[model samples]
Target: MSAPSRPADWDPRASQVLADPIAAYDHMRRTCPVAHSDYLHHSVFRHADVMGIVLDHHTYGNAASRHLSVPNGMDPPEHTAWRRMIEPYFDGARVAAFAPACREIAAALVGALPQQAPVELMSALAHPFAVQVQCAFMGWPQALHQPLLQWVQARNAATLSADPRALAAVATGFDSTIRHLLQERRDAGNAAPDDITTALLRETIHGRPLAEEEIVSILRNWTVGELGSIASSVGIIAWYLAAHPALQSRLRRKPTLLRAANDEILRIHAPLTCNRRVPTRDVTLGGRHIAAGERLTLVWAAANRDEAVFGDPDECRLDRDPALNLLYGAGIHACPGAALARLELEAVIAALLAATASIEPAGSRPTPAVYPAGGHRQVELLLRPAAGS
Candidate 1:
């Protein structure tokens, strides 16, 4: 039999894994069943084990710490309570209403693009969409848009840093911006045109309205969800289609596949590679013992590629079932605004396809690079525009 594995301090594949993770995932699932995560946390790489922790609420609690992720960290009881407070604000009605606004925003951003060759889609397209949509919903000042982008980027880049100082700085900046937005929302009576900020201000939790801190936490969650995750997904979509002309054509013909495509994008290289979890008590997962307070990486990248769960995890299939991908996650913590994100991405992809017959790589575009911590790098797409368009 092979020797027992020693727990590692950090995941060595942290950076390489981000750049092109599926390769790393194959090795991890086989070798390191549960080692110290790249960030000195413990990591669980197998499919069944991740599902076990994700599905088992009692053993693996979500109430780790809000500073890490306000919504993602709150465990049961508190989690449901806080979620109940925020649920109405993110209801389908508001999400659907925002569709028109989101579509317009996508069109306007892409339309504003210069006919000039080599325009980077991330800077000009995805980044702006994420910033505008998020800040608009929060009733935040537009000037803070770029700052939010940088702050969220740092959040993704935290593990790569020698120290956590970078993450701290991003959090500080984000908290400051959130404070300003919360105060403004309060002063404005939490009212915006058919948006979340208004609902946040007006809603009551149990008996009383949510506190400014709670509002801030909600907005913080919004930024991470929109700015960091969606932006990365946008780049992934662009990179994939840019590389695969046939896939782009298929999408052009089968517009309905946009939802499936979005799921595929999220599954392939999710921005949040692994979420941290501290076990409530001793438990066995994947035949290995996991002690309490032993940090573990719920490695989504590996989970997405699990041979047991998704046969042929390496190949990207547009016709693939959307229900299978763990990109939005599962259980109570499933992203509430998933519908809105899909709408925005669909609108953007559809509009891009409608506008250009063809797109190609170009210089001056931000090269789509993935550092260990940061997600998608926006690269310039130099194009001669599709034949007639």
Candidate 2:
């Protein structure tokens, strides 16, 4: 089959787009909802179009990567099996049980913040919170925090470089880390610490225990999903609140609104920019025809902010329908860790609010993260502790 016979719509890696993804995507959605590019082939920008593709997984397959991606890279049946095993880990009881640790981590980080001083939120709080929560959840030690953080940054760099060698090295590096942890559990046998990592070792598929490769894939997926997204989300949330003191004050006064506010803020400035897909057959989408085997990128940053659906993409409203928000995505492939993610985010924001009387932007603007990653690279904010705390 031949590729589309059209000039590229726009470059995704353009300097302007990387500088401000939301604005760039807003333009693409209006100008070319279904657009083509060298980097991201056919890009879908409308909410309706993205939802259509997401729901019809048969036509738009999830096997976009050359490497194994556990359930994420698999379709139904295969995906269904892995998902069933995975969902139990993030069930209501488990998520509820994990809340205290999450809150404790958040509170400790907040306590350590310098009182009423300009601090880089990404390094000072965001990254640490993500690392600690992930470690606590998987029952890993505190020593692994910095290594895991470094891994995430390197992985992001490899992805942006689009160099196969670089990307392969990053994947191998992560597998080594996870493999070592897995071996520790194996060495312990019956006395394996009792945590998520150990629980995964006990899981079986089709009456046989999962292979080392499968376990590595599963853990890799979880680590990537949790580490990068959570940290980016933290930075985005703090940046938003710092820029909008009125909304910050309101959320602080009404603690229950943190969940809704967090979702809204992320939707406005997505922490994860896009997810990939490939066509199983030749099909037309958003007025553009894509050939079979062609790659497609779902621009969540654009779709979530699509004006047709949200009226104003930038408007943060607590009353919007939760079903419409694609922050964790939609359909069969929706994020399994979504419940835990929400709990951690809400817990952190609530703790920060409770501890601080005000969170305002430090004089300088933040450095926005580039493609393949979302949110600010370094968000500076002045945090004032509550009186007598």
Best by lDDT: 2
Tell me the tens digit of each residue's lDDT in model 2 across 1-389.
Answer: 99446798899988898777788899999989999988888899999999999999999999999898898999888898989888999899999999999999999998899977889888888888999999999999999999987887787677767788998898789899999999999999999998999989999987899999999999988887898899999999998998998899899788889999999999999999999989899999977778898999998988999888999788899999999999999999999999999999998888889898999888777777878788888888999889888
Q: TM-scores across all candidates?
A: 0.87, 0.96
Q: What tens-digit string does per-residue lDDT give for candidate 1 at 1-389?
A: 99576656445546665445656767778777666644545677777888778888888887666464556788888788877766666688877877887788778877777654777777788787888877766556679778776765566567345456876777777778777755665676624444456667777777998777777777777776688676777777776777768888888788888778767866766656767677999987766777787766788877877877777775677776666677777778877777777887888877777777766666543443443332456666754455665
How many pairs of residues collide in model 1?
A: 17
TM-score of 1: 0.87
**Model 2 CA deviation exceeding 4 Å by range:** 1-6, 156-164
Model 1's alpha-carbon lDDT is 0.71
